[model samples]
Target: MDNVNQAEFWQQRYETGSIQWDMGQVSPPLKAYIDQLPASAKDQAILVPGAGNAYEVGYLHEQGFTNVTLVDFAPAPIDAFAERYPDFPAAHLICADFFNLSPEQHQFDWVLEQTFFCAINPSRRDEYVEQMAALLKPQGKLVGLLFNVDFGRDEPPFGGTKDEYQQRFEQCFDIEMMEASYNSHPARQGSELFIKLQAK
Candidate 1:
């Protein structure tokens, strides 16, 4: 599919209030990771692509993180986020397709992956990996959770096995950690893998 089509796909979901993957709170594993980071790291450039509602971005802003960018092609969620956090830097709230974003225009110390990977077209998985690598600073990390099971559906939230993810990401990242998440939400328990991969 193309950019306009992908944007409309997500826009319709938000317009209809059908965002089930939205946890309504910062993800537990991600929150724990944020809590452990040093205060000085708050200034690190962080990006959260496909950030619907962006609970993590709000949490980061509340925690004093100075530079957190939220990118999503859909306008509905971005508008909602602006109303919710009026003080969040407008420049950081980007409304653009993740694939179209340029490294020269936007580079980050880290990119927090949540449900973004599974939201994309499966045929574009390799391109996703490449774009992720290009957006990060050298040795930058990509951290978050991934579904470890197949949903067997031809739609968003596409799922995959550990072996598939390992092979796919190894092309651009060194897997620092990708294992069963002990702190996953109840619904995702045992079926989610928390990943911490560094640019290769």
Candidate 2:
């Protein structure tokens, strides 16, 4: 549980089938968001970090978005995703630590978050915010779901409240929206917040 920063932790979890966070399909809230994206945004650079099983990446590809990138340090899920989407462009599948991604080399129009934020060590939350801001183009959006409730656990899927998120992210982003998601998956209904934050 303490090895959240290590790739082996997640890699071993994937090998042992311990990924409770894996939704097994594209998240419904994200699917709805993707569906409403204008066609002009199709080719915009998109990053999906900690993208285990990468259902969102697959969904994006299926929707004709040509420049989507998936980043996950764990190789097991990345390899499995490659097998699941053989026709997906190999170059876009980056198996690297999200924190190590160079801002000079990679900048995104928008980044999609799923469970990635909660999976990291909470102490690294500020680092996550800094790195996310550095990785995005000016005014770039960060859209995804965040747990609006506390799990009170000492493991992955660490949760927080909306106030904590606002205090953490407002330093680098304009809070466009952060409200309870009406379209969350049944199991997560009422517990998650849909956030759309644009980089300042």
Best by lDDT: 2
Report the error of model 2 at residue 29, Å. Answer: 0.6
User: Residue-wise lDDT of candidate 1 within 1-78, one digit each (tens)?
Assistant: 333237888899899999999999999999999999999999999999999999999999999999999999999999
- Supply the TM-score for candidate 1: 0.97
Badly placed stretches (over 4 Å) of model 1 are 1-5
Worst 10 residues of 1 by lDDT: 1-10
Task: Give the TM-score comparing model 2 with the true structure, all chains together.
Answer: 0.98
Q: How do the residues 1-200 of candidate 2 rate in per-residue lDDT, one tens digit apiece?
A: 66999999999999999988878889999999999999999999999999999999999999999999999999998999899899999999999999999999999999999999999999999999999999999999999999987899899789999999999999999999999999999889999999999999
